[model samples]
Target: MPLNSFKSKDNNAKPNRRDSHESTTRRVGVNPTLCRYGGDCRTKGCTFTHVNPPKDGTTKTSDCKYDVNCTRLGCHFNHPNGRLIDQKMVSLPDANQQNTASSRVVSQSPHLEKRAHQRHQQLSESELIEIIDQFLSKVEEFDTNDQESNNSDNEQVLDILEQNALQELRLQKFEFQSAINHLTAEYNSILSSTTDKKYNLLQLRRIKQKLERELKHWESRLPIYARRSDIIEKLEKNQVLILKADTGSGKSTQTVQYICDAHFIDEKQIICTQPRKLAARSLAARVAEEYGCEIGEEVS
Candidate 1:
């Protein structure tokens, strides 16, 4: 066979031997000396078995490594102290032995019992009652102190809250006052504007009444006023008309005023033509004077 064949054969044969060893160990039980870590071993592939030692004083297969110095309880290993442990187990006290032990302990300490009895006898019933009363009084005093401290804490909290509330109220009052002042200023401005408007309206009414009186007086004196109704009727009946009158007969001025007062035209303005600018200006000034207005204002 070649070298590779031999190597493969060796590798295959190793698992068979390992498996046989594991089966044999399982049947015959593991040897404790072969496993250094005992039950605490963490090796997954370890060939040694792991188990706790028996604890009923049964026969063991091996001796403990630490011998008499081993501190493990209920260990299933042979040691020099094993016989002593067995003797102690056999010597454990029964119920009757426990009673005898207790009696022996009491008999050995007679001074302890006598001293306790003497102390009890020294304290009178009245003294015991006094001690209990004193304890109760101290407890009451401690409770009162705790209550007083709690009351003081509560009062402090209330005082802080009251101060905060007062501060908030003052802030609100200031805000309200500011709002009221602003409103008052606005009201005063509005009232002043309204009074001015009323005054202007009264002045305009007075001017209008004076202009009406002047217009009535001028109407009677002007020759064109005698034919006012006839002119208005003719103008209303026709979209175009031609009138002939004397130069100073108030033809230009009175005719325009009549048209304006009668509302013969739907538009707010009226256009009049004159042959000369001087005549137009003079008529405008006369009309302005009659209407109680400036030359450049309503008459213009």
Candidate 2:
């Protein structure tokens, strides 16, 4: 039964009735407008209580928005008495429950599992930058080459995610270098062989077609390509060549390759230095890939 309905037979029960009333009554000093429904307020109603009782000796409960149109008649939001918690606030389980649910989902998802594995071996800043640089170079190259083709809309779309991965980046680099090596090998084979030695015309034509297609597919019209001759001439005449070019200008990879092609073809080693160890390692790895040799062999 409700405390208000209780009746004592004893005449001296005024003090007991006052104590019961005081214990049950919610204080009114707290501002209703300032109360944020951050806890179990949605399902369990407002849990906040006033800091002090009102001077008029009446417990004034605010009109809860959740109370109106409440489907469940017995829910705490539907009644004034059920609005405030007696003691400490009731802790909600939503965040912990959501985290547990998400953990389960990640464990079940193969893609997320792969990402978790990658997270353990996150790409170093330098390596990630190198991947991005190479990927952007490829993109720029494609965009430039695409200008000659009339298919503006049908231009090949490059995905950064595929190219920026360490494994995929290395694989793609190796494949590109392999293609270059194959072309060089074909040229060398044709050159070293005697003029009388008969070559298959169909095979030679196929090789030429393949080389052209590869060139058209990957090679971008870049600043390096345009100024390559000028740079080479300057380097040959001058001891130090200082190139002032922006990132993705193709200087990092192209300059070394140009030097190797022009000056260091036979004897002297071309040494490239970077500020950071990671940068040096990344640059070396890229140069090695470009030269179609192992990292320590032609690069280091």
Candidate 3:
């Protein structure tokens, strides 16, 4: 709401019987989004100009000045005298007498101004201490909130980076497992067939050697491959199995394959979830290859 809408004629004025445009009591402050000072504002009240000028052509340049007599505390447009300069106080010649520079009058006495300055300096030590304490408390609170906001932002960035890395690792694992399964199927076909036995046998030997080397290489690095039987048995007995492992532990891809091979050998309803799009596509393709079916037909 605009500040002028709630401005009272007098701070101590009583409420009228009829609905008045002015409000007697309403908590108010300058909106930061509209305030020009923003974070640099040091006053208790708004420092921006809010009034619009007349659209008529009669309005002069002098009429466009700020309302210096504004009574609101800490108002940036307040008059230098801290009060409106009454026209009556200024000296004026009579209608019969000519106005001259000698008849000019000063607005206020120098003694009154000096007295006001001394009054402000007469504050007690206790009052001074109380003011300092209040200022310090506000400063501490502002600093603490700023530090917390920065820490939260840093933590969020770290979490996103960790999730991306985990997704990439899972995709690579699926691709490697898919190649191994394809080579294994070719090796079995050669052993079971009789036509072109010599050529097929040589190719089968090479496939067997590649499969054995790949399996051994992974088994040495990943602990999950060696515990396949134990994991499968636990899954069979328990209603829900919680498999916890660090990133690149092979649990994401290998655990699903093990469960499908041991328990869901004939069941096409086995479902798996991946954290990212690429990981999901790769895992589905690899599982489909293992099952000897088109993608999304079984294990999608």
Candidate 4:
């Protein structure tokens, strides 16, 4: 017996598991001794701020009233059933065995699980209909529930649906009103800016027009002299002209008319001019075509 006691004490002194039992917590997936900045859950009020993270990393992460794995001094409690959340928080399936539960939202999921989640996410209409469907099913299954039960059940479903539909309509109306308000504000801002700029531009244009009109008045009275049709032709043939005319002068237009009239007598008139048609007979065809188009008159 003495020999066995000695051997057990020697085994107990052999290190490892004893060192593990008394250690405090650290943040998930971090070593406490290596971290200089104190990697604890002081900011978030977490339970596992003192215990070493599990080696396999399958530790449950929950903010709950009852938590067994929580190493916090006060409330490291464990629920009789594993989940701290109740059945109503999830859509529980009503079956013979009542143990089936919906797990909390988690990152990891398989194809069937993801499809189920997608169905749940898009569930506003479905959840409402399901209550009525369940009532009908219950009525069919139970013979004891009578006319009063049916009436009450139907009314309850009706009230629920009416409230839901109204809520949805109100949400849609609010969204529309917000959109209209935003668009109206944007339009009014744009209109005011354009109005201010337009007035400034109009003032500039009026100033320019007034200066141009005054310059024209001064120009009209000055008489240096323009040649007649024959004289202009003679000047062109001799390659010379002497001219001064009113700013409102047909002087520029008359030079071209002189050239055109001279053509009637000159014959073989090479109506040579600028990039513009500088003589009348030269412009006649294009003018006639435009006139025809304007009045819907056909031209061959």
**Among these predicted structures, which one has the highest lDDT?**
1
Q: What is the TM-score of each candidate against the true structure?
A: 0.29, 0.33, 0.28, 0.15
Which candidate number maximizes TM-score?
Answer: 2
For residues 1-300, write the lDDT of model 1, one tens digit per residue: 422232222333333222234533321222333333433445544444333322232323455443554333334445644533334434545324433322332233345545643553355434433543453354356447645764565434566545554444334334334433443354334435545654534333333333343335332344455566678789779988898974345577678877765565566577778786655665665555455454556532
> Worst ten-residue run, lDDT, model 4?
99-108
For candidate 1, what's the RMSD?
A: 57.1
- Model 4 segments more than 4 A misplaced: 1-230, 264-300
Candidate 2 per-residue lDDT, tens place, 83-185, comes to: 2321112232333443332232223444554464344235443443354345445645754654454344332453443223333323434444555566657
Worst 10 residues of 3 by lDDT: 57-66
How does candidate 3 fare on TM-score?
A: 0.28
Clashing pairs in 4: 24-50, 25-50, 25-51, 67-77
Clashes of each: 0, 1, 0, 4
lDDT of 3: 0.45
Q: What ranges in model 3 sit over 4 Å off? A: 1-220, 289-294
| Cα shift from native, residue 278, model 3 (Å) | 2.4
Error of 2 at 72 (Å): 61
Predict model 2's lDDT versus the native: 0.45
Candidate 1 global TM-score: 0.29
- How are the candidates ranked when ordered by TM-score, highest leading? 2, 1, 3, 4
What TM-score does prediction 2 earn? 0.33
**What does candidate 4 score on TM?**
0.15
lDDT of each: 0.46, 0.45, 0.45, 0.35
